[model samples]
Target: MSVDVITNTSPVIWLGRVLSGLAIAFLLLDAVMKLVPIQPVIDTMQALGFNSTTTLARGLGILLLGCTVLYAIPKTALVGALLLTGYLGGAIAIQLRAGNPLFSHILFGGYIGIFLWAGLLMRNNQARALLFP
Candidate 1:
């Protein structure tokens, strides 16, 4: 059997896919790290005033992973995006409360959020219509 691939492609779509892939990969890695709760992660959590509790970290990790999965699936992507937006907003608030750097720490979440939304906008017509129209 022959495979039917997306043939009518454009640069914007390609960029969207790439951005979505990047966000997914990064979020996946982050979730895994939190689940693992390695030494570095624990330290970072303590630095961020999270009490560095393994249970809490893993719970948060699982939640983030769930959000990422939702964002990755086409049917549930809108809900996933909305969830991730809130998650990223919380991250930004944490960094701000921790007195982290403006650009490197606090704004990092905003940057990733931009990529997530922009990628969705470029590749998904439904998302585009919801956002623009």
Candidate 2:
């Protein structure tokens, strides 16, 4: 019988981990900032036509934190990624409605989504196989 071996030391795996880590870090930071309801965050939310209430910010932060946590877990990463994609899509819509710059603001969520999926595809054999097959 042949044993299937997975090597974590591969450079490609390392690159994938790095990319995923960066996305996680950024998302965590964003969640924390919203949880804190910092002045700048509140100001930005108001500018985006969202309710500037601290309660709303905290609620959003909690949702984001939960999603990010799921994404950080290997088993639930796909579900988390899907949730994040939905969240990002909403963000993109909001930015577009606010007439934000296309590249810098409107498409920012797409950029993050790319990194998220790319990292997952590279590191997870199951994901790659599922997609490619």
Error of 1 at 65 (Å): 0.3
What TM-score fits each model? 0.91, 0.91
User: After superposing candidate 2, which stretches have Cα over 4 Å from the reference?
Assistant: 1-9
Residue-by-residue lDDT tens digits, candidate 2, 18-71: 898999999999999999999999999999998789999999999999999998
Q: Name the candidate that leads on TM-score.
A: 1
Model 1 spans with C-alpha error above 4 angstroms: 1-9
User: Candidate 1, 129: how far from true, in Å?
Assistant: 1.0
Return the TM-score for candidate 2, rounded to 2 decimals.
0.91
Cα displacement (Å) at residue 64, model 2 = 0.9
Model 1: per-residue Cα lDDT over 31-90, one tens digit each: 999999999999999999987799988999999999999999988888999999999999
